[model samples]
Every structure is written in structure tokens, then in C-alpha cells.
Target: MTGFVYSESYLNHITGTGHPESPDRLKAIADHVRNSEYWNSLKSIKPNVISTNIIQLIHSGSYINSVSEACENGFPFLDFGDTAICRESYSVAKLAVGGVVQAVDEIFNGNLDNAFCAVRPPGHHAEAESAMGFCLFNNVAIAAKYAQKKYNIEKVLILDWDVHHGNGTQHIFDSDPTVFYLSLHQYPFYPGTGSKNETGTGDGLGATKNFPLSAGSGDKEYMDIFENILPEIVIQYSPSLIILSAGFDAHYRDPIANMNVSEESFSRMTKIVVKLSREVCEGKLISVLEGGYDLNALVSSVEHHLKALQGN
Candidate 1:
């Protein structure tokens, strides 16, 4: 199997107690990666620092500055509801963003065939100006813009499989034709945005595809959509690269959300995505870990996710 990239600072370790988004989630991932034989495929690497100027490619100064201010003034909630920040949160979030950007660069430069970012403060729910659902920075979006600006790649595909819709990601790219945002998640959930009719608008019309399955939808329904819809739309778009907002909270054992996506589903799903990347983009794929509350489920699912990613 081809070697991959990961990092230790991905283990930021400072959210709050039993806060659905806790450090333990990443700790479990780190521990498993260390114990598993598959760990050999992953080498620890540092992010190539992209400046605030580079970050501005996706986020506004106000949003970036405000989060920094909140970290300075003291820990305050960043989300409208659940997300919060402590003193170290800002620094750790930087590492998280760095991890994604580095993963993007490594894949684009052929240092690794593909990479999975094991960082936290997950980014899909983070928008251009607001942080929501535990996300402080839009990691995947920043990578998308970096790819477009630096590589001159015209089309990038973002696939959100987080059990909840990536309203923030969609809103950020809804008007841009150069990026395609596709989400397959539970309908009528938190942030409540994805729907069958809520496809992309303006120049991005038909680019944003949503498959909002019912609350109890399990591997069967999820797999059905992936086999048919995901490949068809993505192949049509013919993305230069595929970025995954990979969230494991959809697993049946997760405490926060209740979709029945098991560990096997994660591996199988990754297999399909890799298949698409191979077919069209020569396998330029990068995945960033997102929302997953249950520690056991998160660990198990992420392990499966990486195994499939490594073609192990």
C-alpha cells in the first residue's frame, strides 16, 4: 500500500469536559493509528504555513480576526449554540487548518497518493464569516481555494458525508461555478439546509447536489445513493480533485446524531470515492475528519475510513 500523511498536533486536546466535541475523539484516532499495523502507511508531517493572505482566499478578514479576538478576550462560544473556544483553541485550530492545507499540498505535489487529515474543530459547518457546529475554520474550503489559486485548477469537488448537511460549505460556494459541493446527509437536522431542491444556484447551479435521506437511513440507503448518485454527478463534473468533509458521527453508535452508518459503511464509502478519484482525477483526493461524538464509534469508524483510504 502507498504511504500517507498525518500529524500529532492533529491531537489539539483542549475542548471542554464531555463536550460532544472533546479531545478524546482525536486521542482515540491517534492511539489507534499508533497501534494499528496500517500506521506504517502514514508518516507524520508539518503543514506548509499558508499566510492570513492565503486563508483569505476562502475566509474574510472579519471572520478570521473575530475568532482570534474571541481567543484573546477569553473563551466564548463561537457557534450560535454549541461550538466554543478556549485559550489554546485558536492555536490548535490553526494546526487543524494547517493539517488540511498540508494534506492538500502533499497530494497535489505527489508526496502521497492521497491523504486524510486527522485534525479536529471540524470545518464543514464553518462558513465564510461564521463558525458553527464545532468548526472554527473552513479547512476544506481553504484547501479548495488554494488548489484553484495556486494550481489554476478550475473545478474542485467537495463531498460532504457527515450525516448532517454542510450548510456552511454550500453557502460559501453556492455562487461559484469553479467548485462543486455535494452533500448526502440526514434531512431536518442541525443547521438544517440540505434538501433535494437546494441544488447550487447562479453559475454553480446543478453543481451542488443534495441527497437528504431520512433520519434512520442506514448503510443500505447511504450505499444506494453513493453507488448511483455520487459517481454519476461527480463523473459529470470531472473534478480536478476531490475533497471529502468526512464525518463519522453518522455511525449508529454515535451519541450526537442518529444515522446508522456503521464502520463498514465508512470503509466501503471511501472505496467508492477512491474509485472515482482513480477514474477521473488520477486519485488526487484529500479527506478531513469532521463531526463524530462517540469516542468508540469515532475510533472504529475512522480506522475503517483510513484502511479503505490506504487500500489495505
Candidate 2:
């Protein structure tokens, strides 16, 4: 069974009106899953209380404090543009990270082969010291570091399929050879990072890979990249765990970005990842929600993702 980690607090991280990253995003997924046929197959779990020190593993102390202070003092946005935070955002963001960490623990403890975290205020765009692109804390990055620190996981592979490149995640692990960050996002897009030439640096050379697809690229292009490039890399790296930054914004129905991927395509990608995980890492895998703005597309896409995660 695939564990599903979520919490009601996620809806409280308010972004106000007219923001794409609103509370409705999570609600849509929640409603759809509860009413779906695969709902019973999922083992739902609530997020645990995450400690501040654990969060410090991925973000600096000063930066962490700054976020807390901003939330306490009621700031509308963070230092960078587009990262909106309310008074409850800091606490709720920690819960989001907690969800991912809990999923990692469940996977490593033999409780589940894989899990998916349905979280909001997406984290892939949040850097170590700053928040941007509607993220306050880097959830998946913190979970990767936590798996390393607590479970002695030597290598973690982060596969980000968000429409916008996970610039923040790439920045955090750019110099670390232990973590391999691969992102396939829209090129010349928002935040303007994730160029093909921007591989890793220092000891982490070639650890970072980016495949910036065109705006209208669809299933054929995405599947070709995954089938051709990802398998070889996963087999060679042999990571201790695989983490997916699953984003449904690439769906053709999504208004945020211009990709033509379908829900069925997400299933194929999940199956490929599952097969690779089985071959390389004892079937250990976990995924966290990132960017998926269109309500209908996000709901249907997550359902398909969960079906694949459940090995159906």
C-alpha cells in the first residue's frame, strides 16, 4: 500500500484572493481522493510535529528565524517576490515538511514501499535562505537531508517534474555529490533558472540534470526523455531513496504553464519510476506535491499518480 500524508493545517496557509496557490488546490485533491475508488487502498497518515533543529538541516538558522519573525509580525510576502506568507504559514509549512519526513520514515521502516505527500505552499521553489514562487520552506530538500541525517541514507535522487524548474532545490544541493537533483521544467519560464548548461559544481559535477522542454511539449517528448535518460542515471547512481517533486501544472488544462501532458502520462512516469526504484533501491520511493494550479487537472492527475503509486 502507498501511504498518503496530509493535514488540515495545510489549508490554513492562506495566500489571499487571486493567488494561484490558494487553499482550494489542496481541497480539490482531498475531495477527489476521498471519493475515488483508490481511496481505500491508500494508508492515510497525518503529519507529525517537526522539530526546529530538523528544519535547520536544510535551511540556515538565521533564515529560519527570519521566516518565523515575518510570520509573527504578519508580513505579506517574503524577501523574494511572489512568496506570500500569513501568520499561520510558518507553522503550516513545518507541517508540510513533517509530512514528507513522515513518508520517508514509513518507507524506510518497511511500513510501505512508497508514499505521497499532498501538501500545499509548494517547497521546490523555496531556497535554503529565502522563499520564492509561493514557497516558504523547502519540504523535499529538508526530507532528503533528514533521510541522510537520521536514517543514514547516503544518496537521494530528487526528480522534479514541475512545470516551473525547482531552482531552489537545485541551489540547495548544487555542491553536494550525495544528492542528485534532476528537473524537467518549462524553459525560459518563471524564476528563469534550470538551464541545460547549469550542471552541478565542485564535487557534485554532473549530479544536477535539467531538461527544459518547450511550452507545448506533450507525452511523447516527456516519455522519450524519461525512458531514454532517467533509467540509465538511476541504475548508475543507485540512490538509497527516490523522491519525486510531482507537479501537475504541466497538464494541458492548467492555466499556469503551457505543457500538454495528460493524466495518463503521469501514470506512465510513475510506473517507470517505480520500476527503476525496484531495480535500484528496494522499491523505496516517496513523492511530494508541488505545482498544479488547475483544480480539475490537479485532482485527476493526483488520482492517477496514486493509482500508479499503489502499483495498480
Candidate 3:
């Protein structure tokens, strides 16, 4: 198996000074992943930039142009207070999307059983046509749709266990039942979406599941929910491929949000998801980093995450 990592060389230009979602978030995780024993189990590569058409699969041309435009002329603050763009934002965002795509390539090519793309600015917050929540593009959504278009997989399973709900991802696929979107997040959290009642709509109805926990939720709450909800959903759906929205902001030490998840908590949650992938997707899984603010938590949590990915 391979755990693909992108250098912070690109991320350096994606954020503003004093940003929580800054490039250092990725650097910390990379250092942890590479220095660990699990690094020996992984083949490493820098993620490439995505082609324009590849991005157009889920994002509209206008939205794509907006990002490109932002890249050319310095940058613009994304929307409200969610995200920012800079001269190199488009390039790095494409690299993030390409990281997931390349992970899919490695799994499909049989070079690896699975991968974890340690990339940012985190996705799951970027909608189809909008760049928000520090995300310039929806990397997971982009990779999922790319898998379908390129492989005719028809069904993709996205497990987003970020402390905050994956509102953008849920929004893009809410009406498209071809994908099963499962998310567990803190209730009344940022972006204020992903309520239990926000199950898919129309043909997509019942194809989505959201479990919103209270603040201070920890491993016990997470493990309990996964054992009960995750298994039933995966068995019923039987997805051809699985993608993980791995976010570490849930760690107890994170400054941006309140959640009782610890480093060991990340390890436990990752192990649960890995087991499910083994049963349903033939171990075909690609994990992409979404959000994790605390440097130490990010580093330690990723080390834990990669160990589980290595079957340790």
C-alpha cells in the first residue's frame, strides 16, 4: 500500500498569514507520516496538478475560472470568512485534487491496495460551484466523480468523520443517489449543516446518512456510532470504492473547535473504517486530509491514521 503525500511547497501560497488552515497544518502531518515506521510500508510520491477537464467533472467552468482568475491577480478572500485565494491557489488546489486522483490510479493500477492523500486546504467544505471553508475545490468529490467517469464504478462511498459536517460534499451529491455520503460531525457546528434530518433528497433520499454528536464527544461515542451505523449502511450499499474525508480537528487539543477526540481516538476511528473497507470494497480506499488545526494533534493523529492504513 502507499500513503501519498504532497509537499507544503505549494500550500505555502494557498493561505493568508495567521490562518488556521495554513500550510503548516499539512507540513506537520507529513513529518509525522514520513518519520514513522509506517513510512516503510508506503510508496511516496508528490501529487500532480489536475487537468482542467478533470476539475470540470463536478465544478462548473465559471467556478473554475474564478479560481484561475484569483490565482492570476494576487488572490481574493473566498466567501464570508471561510476561505482565501492567492497567486498559486489554483495550482495547489489542483494538486490536492490530483493527489486523490493519483491515489485512485495507484489502487486501480494494482501498485497499491489503498492510499491516504495528506493534502490541503481541506475539502468537504467546498461546494460544487463555490469555494468555501478554506477549500478552493472539492477534492474528495472531484476524485469520487472521476472514479465513476473513468471506471464506470457507478457507486462510491464517502465516509466523512471530520468533527465538522461535510456540508459542501453533502450538498453536491444530495440529489445524486449514485454516491452514498456518510458523515458524523458535531451538532450545531460550523457551517451549520448536516443535521440528521438532512438525509438525501429526491432520488438521493435515504442514500445519505448524518450522525451529529454533541460537543465533547469522544472515542466511545464515535466507536459506538460506527459499529451500529457504518456496517449496516456499507452492507446495504456495497460500494465499489471508498474515500475517507480524514480530518483531525476533532482532537481534544484543536484550537478551532471543541471536541474531545484524542490522538488515540483518531486511531480507533480509522481502524473501524479500514475494517469496513476490507469487507465492502476489497480494501480499495483513498483517504484525503480535510481539516486538522492543532499541529501536535495533526502530527500524532496522522501517525496513528497511517499505522491503521498499514494494517498495524
Candidate 4:
């Protein structure tokens, strides 16, 4: 069975009015999933609030404190302006990380084959010391650390297809061979990272891989890499668990990004990952939401993704 990790409290992050990373993103997905055919078949799970101590696995203590203080003092944004927050944002971000960690626990315990964490304020952008790109805390990064520490997992493969390169996740594990970070994103894009030459350093020298695609690239381009390039790298890495930073902003309908990918491509890509996880890691995989701006596109793309996750 596929586990769906979420919490109503995730809606309480409150990025603000007119923000692309608004609560409506999750609401739209939640609404559609509940009304869709997969609701009953998918296991529903509410995330518990993880302690700040767990968050320190990925974020520095001072940075975590600053986020709390900023929210408590009613700062409008965590960074210059993109990452908006409210009093509940710090706690909500914790819940988002917790959701991913809980999914890890569930998969390890064999309660579910895999999971998709429908959470926000979307991570993969937040760094160890600062929040960026509408992300307050790095959810997937924390989950990787949590899994390593608790489950004694030796290797993790983080596949980020977020349109924007997951600079935060990449940098966090830039030198750690235990976590391999692979990304396929628009090059020369926002956050200004993820170049072909920016592979990992030191012990992680070859663990980081990036496939930078051009604008207007659609299904054929993405599929070429997924079918030809991705499988080889993933099979060789042979991680203990797979984590996907599943972002749908590459959809043709999304406003914030420029890519021509459709929902079918998302499903196809998910299926590839699912098959890879099953082969390489006994189907131990977890997908965490990152960015999908257009509400309709988000809903449709997520539906396709979840269905693929269910092996439908």
C-alpha cells in the first residue's frame, strides 16, 4: 500500500496572499485526492510534531531559533521576500519534516511499501542556516539524516525534479557520500545553482549528479534522461532508500517556471522511480512535495504521481 502523509496543520503555514507557495497548493491536492478513486486505497496519515532537536539534524540550532523568533515576532518573510511566514509557520515546518520522517518509519516498519508527503512550506530550498525560495526548513534533508541515524541506513538517493535545482539539499550533502543528490532542473534558473560542474566534493566527489535541461523542454527530453541516464546512475548507487523531491512547477500550466512538461510525464517519471526503488531498495521510497504553483496543474500532476506511486 502507498502511505499518504499530511496534516491539516500544514495549511496553517500561511505564506500570505498572492504568494505562489500558498496554502491552496496543498488544499487543492488534498481536495482532489479525497474525491478521487485512490482515496480509499491509499493509507491516510497525519504527521506528528517533531521536536526542534530532530530539526537540528539538518539545520543549525541558531538558524532554527531565528526562524522561531522571526515567526513569533511577525516577520513577513524569512529571506528577502519570497519565504513568507506567520506565528504557526515554524511549527508547521516541523510538522512537514515530521511527516517525511514518519513516512520513513512506516516504510522501514513495513506498514506501507512507500509514501508521498503532501507538505509545505515546501522544502529543498531552505539551507542549514537560512530559508530561501519559500522554504523554511529542509524536510527531505532532515528525513535523510533521521533515517541514517535511527534506521542505520547507509546510503540514500535523493532525486530532485523540481524545475529549480535543490541547492539546499545539494549543499547539505555536498560532501557526504552516504546521501547521493541527483537533480534534473532548468539550468541558469533561479537560485543560480546546479551547474554540470558542481558535483560533490571530498568523500562525495561523484555522488552528486545533475542533468540541466533547457526551457520549453517537454516529455521527450525528460523521458530520454529518465529512461536512459537515470536508471544507470540509480542502479549503480543502489541506495538503501529513495527520496524524491517531487515538484510539478515544470508543468506547462505553472506560472513560476518555464518548462513544457505535462502530467503524463510526471506519472511516467514517477513510474521509473518506483520501478527503480523496487529493484534497488526493496520498494523503500518516499516522495516529498516541493513546488507546483498552478492549482489545477498541481492537482492533476499530483493525482498522476500518487497513482503511479500506488503502482496503478
Candidate 5:
């Protein structure tokens, strides 16, 4: 069965009014899944609050303390302005990381084939020392580190399909060969990091890959890379685990981004990843939520993603 990691407490990390990354996002997904036909089939998993030491796998101690202080003091935002947070946001962010880590544990323990984490305060933009793009902690990055340390996973493949480039994830793993970071995002966009020439560095040379597509690129443009380019990289890397920074903001209806990707395209992409995981990693894949602004579009896209993960 496919695992579904979530927690109602995730909604506690409120971003205040007019914020794109709000609690309603996960609430919509939770409500949709509960009412869907696949509700009974999905192995529901509740996430526990993990220790801060686990978070240190990706973020520094000082940075973690800074986040805690900011939240404790009720700071309005973490970064310059995008990452709004309240008093409970720090705890909620830890729960988000815990959710992803639990999914990894379930997969490694032979309890599930694959899983999707419906977490809040989307994490792709978080760096090792700072929070960016509405992320307080890097969920997928911490999970990757946890898997490698606890389960002795030899290699990990992080595929980020967010509309904005995951500059933090890329920079975190840029010098590490054991983890390969691949990002397909809109170019010249927010943060302005992912570019064709910005491959890996040091020991991780050629391990990082970026496919920057211009705005208005739709399913055809994305599928070309997913079908034609992604498989080869997966086979060659032969990682022990596959993690997706599953962001739905690339959808046509999303208010934040300017991509025309449809829900059907998200399903097809998930199917391809599922196939690749089966071929390379025994179908051990974990998808962590990142960015998806529009409530209806996010819900539909997540439904399609979950169905594909279920092999429906």
C-alpha cells in the first residue's frame, strides 16, 4: 500500500491573511483525500514531532536557534518577507520534517511501497543556514540525510519539480556525491539560482542537473525532460532512494507562477517516477509537499499525484 503521512497539527502553522502558503492548502488536500474513493486504501500515517537534533542533519544549530527565537518572539517573517510564521510555526515545521522522515522509515521497514507527505510551510527553499521562500526547515533534505545515516542508504536522488528553483537544496548537496540534486524550474524567476550551467561542484561534479524552462511551457515541455532525460539519469545514478520535491505551483491555475501544466501532466510525471523507482530502487520513493498555491488546483493535482502513486 502507498503511505500517506499527514497531521492536522500541520494547519497550526498559520501564515496569516493574504499569504499564498496558508493552512487551507493542506486542509483542502486532507478533505479531498478523505472524501475520495482511495481513502480506505491509503495507509494513513500520523507524524510525530521529531527532535531538533534530527533537523540538524540539514540546518545548522545557530540557524535552528534563530528560527526558534523568531517563532517564540512571534516574528512576522523568517526571511526578508516571504516566510511568514507564528508562534507555532517552529513546531509545525519540525512536524513536517518528521512526517517525511516517518515516510522513509515506513518504506525502509517494508511497511509501504511509496508515500506522499502533505506537509505545510513548503520546504524546497530552505537553506542550510537560513529560511527562504516560505520554508523554515528543509523537509526532504533532512529526510535524505536521515535515510543515509540510519538506513545506510548509499545514494539518493532528489528531483525538484517546483516552479521556483530549489536553490537551498541544490546548494546543500552541491558538493556531496552521494546525493544527486536535479531541478526543473522556471528560469529567471524568484531567487534566480537554477541555470543550465549551474551543475555540481567539487566531489559532486556532474551530479547536479538543472533544466530551466521559460514561462508558458506546458506538459509537452516538461514531459520531454521527464521522459527523455530523467530515465537515463535515474538508471545511471542507481540510487537507493528517490525523493520528489513535489510542488504543484507549475499548474496553469496557480496564482503565484506562470506555467500551464495540467493535472493530467502531473499524473503522467508521477507514473514515470514510479516506474523509474521500481526499476532502480524497488519502488521506494518518498514525495514531500513543497509549493502549490491555488487551493482547487493544488487539491486536484495532489489527487492525480496520489492516484498515480497508487498505480491507479
Candidate 6:
């Protein structure tokens, strides 16, 4: 059955008012999920606090220390960057990573058909040694590494449909052929990393696939790309586990990004992923929340996404 990982501590990673990545994002989704009919059927799991040793799988030691010290000293922001943090952010970020890790473990252990992590301080923009873009650690990236290290998974597929490209994730596994990173995002946008030509490097060449769409691209365009490319890539890669950098910011109502993806589109896209997992990996899949600014849209899109996850 489809399961979910959550923690009230996630709300402690506050970014202040007017900040797009606020605590309410997760709160809205959590409340909606609990009130839904599927609540009784969905397994609710609490994530264990992860070790710094597990974090070292993807982040450098100095960077980890710096983040810890910053949180301890109560630095306003990790850098003179867009990412913001408070006293509890360091621990909360670690918990966010833990949530994804727990999802990976459950899926691999046959306790769940799939899982979703409603986490905060999104991680796609975080690099191996730095925290930026409202992120501390690259949660999904770490989960991918965890799957490889702990589970002996041979090949993993990461599908990111966030409005913005997952630069950190792409770069992390860019030179490793074992992980295939595929992203569909708005081109010529923030952080500006994803491009058609920037496939991969060295042994990882062609393992990374990017489909950069325009700002106004909507459901049809997104689905067209998915139908054309996603299935073919899944068949070619034959991933043992599929991880999603699932961000709802692409919704037309989202404040931070420009895209026209609707609630229905998210379900359709999710159905595609679900079917792919069934074909390629016995339905082993996990989605880690990335970005979504609008509360109502985030909540509704997540409901649709989970409904698809539950095979509803």
C-alpha cells in the first residue's frame, strides 16, 4: 500500500512571513491528508532523526559543520543567499533528510508500495558543499545515495518535475552512470542551470536528461514531453528504485513559479510514474517534496498526487 512520512518538527524550519517556503505549506498538506478518506488506508510513519554520518554521503564535512554552527549561533541565513533559517532549522533539515531515507527503507523492505515525504526547506538547489535556495541538505539526492549504499541497488532513476531544475541533484550524480537524473522545468529561470546541451559528464554522459520548457507551458505540453520521453528512458534505464523530486510549484496558482499545471495534471503525471514503476521496479517509488508556494494549490495538488499514489 502507499504510505507517507511526516513530522511536526518540519514546521519548525521557519523562513518568516512573506517567505514563499513557509511552514504552512506542509501544514496545509498534512491537514488535508488527515481529513481525506484515504487517511485510514495510508500508513503514517514517523521519520527517525538521521545521523550526520549519513549526511556525509552527499555533503562535505566543512559544509556540514558550517551549517551546524550557523544554526547554533542563530545565523539569519546560511549565506548571503535566498535560503533562510532559524535556530531549529539545522535539526529540522536533518529530519527532512531522515524522512526521505525512511521512505527509501520502507519501500525497499516491502513495507510500502510507495511513499511521499512532505518536507520543508526544499533541497534541489542545495549543492554538495553549500546550502542555497531555501535548502540545507539535498534530501532527495541523499536518498538516492542511501539507496545505492545501503540497499545495493544497482541503478536508480530520479524524475524531477519541479518548475525549476534540480541543479544540485543533477550535479551530484552527473558523473555517476548508475543514477539517471531526468528533469522537466522552466528554462532560462532561477539559478539557470538546466539546459538541453548539459547532459552529463565523463562516464555519466547521457545519463542526465533535461526538458526545459517555457514559462507558460501547461498540462498538455508537460504530458506531451512525458509521454514522448519518460517511458522510453525508464525502459532503457530499468531503475531498481524510482525517486521523485516532486514539487507542486508548477501549478498555475503557485506564487513562485510560472507554469499552468493543474491538479489533474499532477495526477496524470503521477499515474505515468506509477505505471513506469510497476513496469520497471515492482512499484517501488518515493516522492520528496521540493517547492510549492501557494497553500491551497499545494494542498490540492498533493491530494491528487497521493490519490494517484494510492491507486485511487
Q: lDDT of candidate 3?
A: 0.84
What is the lDDT of every predicted structure here? Answer: 0.83, 0.92, 0.84, 0.93, 0.94, 0.92
lDDT of 2: 0.92
Q: Mind giving the per-residue lDDT tens digits that candidate 3 earns over 208-294?
A: 899988888887898788777678888789998999999988888989888888888687777877888889888889999988888
Q: Per-residue error at 150 for model 1, in Å?
A: 1.0
lDDT of 4 by residue, 198-290 (tens): 899999999999988888888999999999999999999999999999999999999988899999999999999999999999999999999
Runs of candidate 2 with Cα error greater than 4 angstroms are none
Q: Indicate whether candidate 3 or candidate 4 has the larger lDDT.
A: 4
Q: What is the lDDT of residue 122 in candidate 3?
A: 81
Judged by lDDT, which candidate is best? 5
Residues 246-281, model 6: lDDT tens digits: 999999998888899999999999999999999999
Q: Is 3 or 5 the stronger prediction by TM-score?
A: 5
Alpha-carbon shift of residue 311 in model 4 (angstroms):
0.5
RMSD of 3: 1.3
Error of 1 at 46 (Å): 2.6
Clashes by residue pair, model 1: none
TM-score on alpha carbons, each prediction: 0.96, 0.98, 0.96, 0.99, 0.99, 0.99
lDDT of 5 by residue, 162-252 (tens): 8999999999999999999999998889979999998899999988999999999999999999999999999999999999999999999
* Residue 7 miss distance in model 2 (angstroms): 0.6
The 10 consecutive residues of candidate 4 with the worst lDDT sum are: 13-22
In candidate 4, the residue pairs with backbone N, CA or C atoms under 3 Å apart (3 or more residues apart, or in different chains) clash, namely none
Deviation of model 5 at 299, angstroms: 0.6
Better of 4 and 5 by lDDT: 5
lDDT of 1 by residue, 1-312 (tens): 333345555555466676888877777788888888877667666665556776677788988888888888876677654677887777777777777788777777887878888787788988888888888888889889888887888899999999889988999999899899999888888878998898888888888888888888899998998897788888999999999999998999888777898899899999999999999898989888888888888888888888888876
